[model samples]
Target chain A: MKSNLELLTIETIAEGFRNEDFKPSEVMEAFLENIKVKSELNAYIDTYEDDAVSKAAEFDKLFKEGREDLPILSGIPISLKDIFLVKDKICTCGSKMLSNYVSNYDSTVKKRLDDQGVIILGKTNMDEFAMGSSTETSYFGPTLNPWDHERVPGGSSGGSAASVAGRLAVASIGTDTGGSIRQPASFCGIVGLKPTYGRVSRYGMVAFSSSLDQAGPLTHNVRDSAILLDTLSGFDNRDTTSLKLAPTKCYEALKKNDFSPSEFKIGIPYDLLREGLDSEIDQSFNLLVAQLEKMGFKIIDVSLPSSKYAVAIYYIIAPSEASSNLSRYDGIRYGFNEESTPETLEEFYVKNRSAGFGEEVKRRIMLGTYALSSGYYDAYYLKAIKVKRMMQKDFNEAFKKVDCILTPTSPELPFKLGEKKDNPLSMYLSDILTIPANLAELPSISIPFSISSSNLPIGLQLTSNKLCEDTLLKVSSILEREVGFKSKT
Target chain B: MVEKKEVLKISKLSRLLIEENKIDSFLKNFSEIIEYINLLDQADTTEIGKDEEIVEYSFRDDSEIEKLEVEDVVKNSAKVENNFFAVTKVIDEE
Candidate 1:
């Protein structure tokens, strides 16, 4: 049995409401009860139970009045990762620096969700400043994996993925920078999509490597992901980077019956799978490739040689951007400020930041600062940017021959908590495969392919060229139908 | 190679305070990372340009500035008095 009402997919919940099988208030209460029972997961940093109920009640009234004007996501409960600002709520961004910080305005995404009548379940946990891949670096404490509490549910967007995987929330919004969403979604056995950069506005998301960050959804299935993406995507003048392309009616895209495998070509990167991948994952990925071939899709071998350097390039670029982006937190604008008087302005800036940020965040900030420093800029940061360009060029070349690239989202399965805490390199290597998509500004999705014999979740990643989210979703939906993994209760 | 002193300097540049006791461990780990990054320097980057299109512009706006009241800003802090945030003194004044 499902543990709570909030765990149901948006489609399922909407269908039930339409059938009058259960009231919207009943579903809201079920989610509140589930939150109480699953406190150990730390999936939520804060839940607006009263607000959610009121919204659900409002939706119920709309149903009673037979209002056809209701939005597509009426009464659905969606979790927001702490990084996204929800007006008047504490939007801590999972950092000690902003632990008590509350937002006075909603992010464009939040306003859109609210306008569409999606109920805000709560704010989910994340890596401190969305830096780590394992969610272990969250200031609020690591979110336990629901499948096995000892292991992490991938990170940066780990809590959002875990909440969806554990059925705590039907769907969630997570920010992806260097694989924050897809990696965690892979580890947690769910669907996570990072749309083309600028497809979603970044107006009120607390910045972390601003150029690379894009918010996407984590959901149980591809259809739900497409539905959420439809609402989430579109241009907003507030975010200069927001895309100005025509709005895609993604829900309508889902209904098209032309999902024949013969129409698609799949690309597999042989080198990426050969070196860093685990044996089980390789076997599973090959098996999925074979399954796709049997289903009538053409498979082709593709090369993206520069992608080998993506992890190194991403680490430098992301941190460099993060260093600059996070500079505003020097105790003056929105975070903790040290009270002591300093002889110089520089010393005051140093003291406030030194006291405010946590260890992992500080480490990245320093790594970033050094890369961007005067003498080293050409040697480190600038070189990474060049590599980033080549990585994107490699993808551009590869996409000329194939509709999508398929690979294991993560090379290895989830590791035990604290296993790689002492070794930052090992942790960084975990996100190697997924970072290239972010660097290329392409769209990718991670869908649970098969569960290990050990019962841990393993994910298959499907990546399409820039703004080709439709094909990615169509392919993922076909695979989801074939693989058939049940959602965890 | 990144030296121990360099790590300390980078730490200072980034506004991070490394306790004297943790310096040894920090240096050992940081040097390993720097060594790994050195691998990128050896790549045949002859074709790679110094000015690449991938470099993103900074997301700050210099055109429109919104001035705020000092009172409106400090009113939300948990510990504030005299239009300033109260905290433990961090440095000695000259």
Candidate 2:
């Protein structure tokens, strides 16, 4: 019964809450129990067992009192990536630099989840400052994949993905800068969505690559992604980048099932998959497409030509922005070694950062500083921006011909731990497929649909034009129904 | 290829200290990434506009709202005196 409760989806749990099958406190106990048993998976950096239990008990009391005005997500259990500030709780960003730093206020998403009375299980682990492709760089240590202890869960949201995949948390919220969310979700065989660039507010979330970073849900299924996105979406005066688009109705569309697959033309960039993709994933993708074709949908062969340069463009632009955004850890304000007395301010900053940051974080900071340096700025940073515009134009042209594009989320299956750690270049290629959507500021989702022969999970992705998450979710739900994938991993 | 001195210079500009022993491996990794990003030069960007993409946000009304306590703001500082952050003295006194 405890294992079964851990596997319940957001929708089912919400229904069970209304039906009085079990109280919110019971759900909390079951999940905390699973987390305790699977403690070695390292999915969580900190588990708020006492706090979560108390909150769940309070909600259960409210439920028993017959409160009718409670929110639909009031009793849902979820985990948050450590990047968001939770007001007095430590917001580490998986780096030693701010490992013990406490946030004074809540991030917008954190406030939203709390306002809805959702029980936050704990803060999950991640790459240091969300810099690396593997969770190995985290100061707290790597989060092992629950499916196979020797393999990675893909990162920097590896712990977020693992928490949901391991059933440690019913769902999780993770930030994506160049496929940080989807890549891990794919590797872990779960649903991960990176909402349109400005769809969600980033007021209190730590900045990685400001232009590319956007948070979304990693869930067990498509409907759950929609449910979480709806709660997290809206315009915020605090976040100037927040879009003024209409609030998402993804969950509503999912329940209504109002979309027909026949009305949409799905595009597959066969040329992009001609190389670099694993044979099994390539075959699985083709089979899924054929299945969609059999369901009365028209398939088109479309290519975003400039997408070939996604990695190169992303590397230049992300690091350039990151170098500037991460300039705040000067140790005078707040950070590791804030208490240290150094000979000079410069020495203080250099010393704290050198000791605090891992190799990957320093590597990025150096690369970014070099790219944005006076002489080389125009050659690298400016050129990458113009090329990013070209990539956007390519997507614009493709979207005119196709309703949405479909592709494999990752080029390969879950890799063994340390398989690509030594090779930074190859690690960057892990997000090659998921990076284009981020570059073009488009909305996309990765859906886990099949398990490979070796018992690893594989995911297929869908990308829709910006502010079209309704259609994206609708079509994905249809695909989800047709594929009938559940109990992933 | 990035040389040893260049890596040190950039690290200085970024305010990061790089010990001498790790400089070799750091330079190796940094140069490879720099080389990888050079592939951007292959794109024909002559007609492309280099103008920065501007995202226009409406100016919000300036209204007083609840604010953080001075103590909350400076609580993380190593030295706090009279509700302010105290850092290392930068100017040399005569």
When summed lDDT is taken over every stretch of 10 residues in candidate 2 chain A, the lowest stretch is: A480-489
Classify candidate 2 by CAPRI docking class.
medium
Model 1, A202: alpha-carbon shift in Å? 0.6
Give per-residue CA lDDT, model 1, range A225-287, as digits (tens): 999899989877678788776656777877885777898999999977778788898888888
RMSD of each: 2.9, 1.4
TM-score, candidate number 1: 0.94
Model 2, span A402-421: residue lDDT tens: 88899999998998888977
> Which candidate wins on DockQ?
2
lDDT of 2 by residue, B38-82 (tens): 998899989887675777674567985559989899988767789
User: DockQ of every model listed?
Assistant: 0.31, 0.77
Best by lDDT: 2
Estimate the TM-score of every prediction: 0.94, 0.98
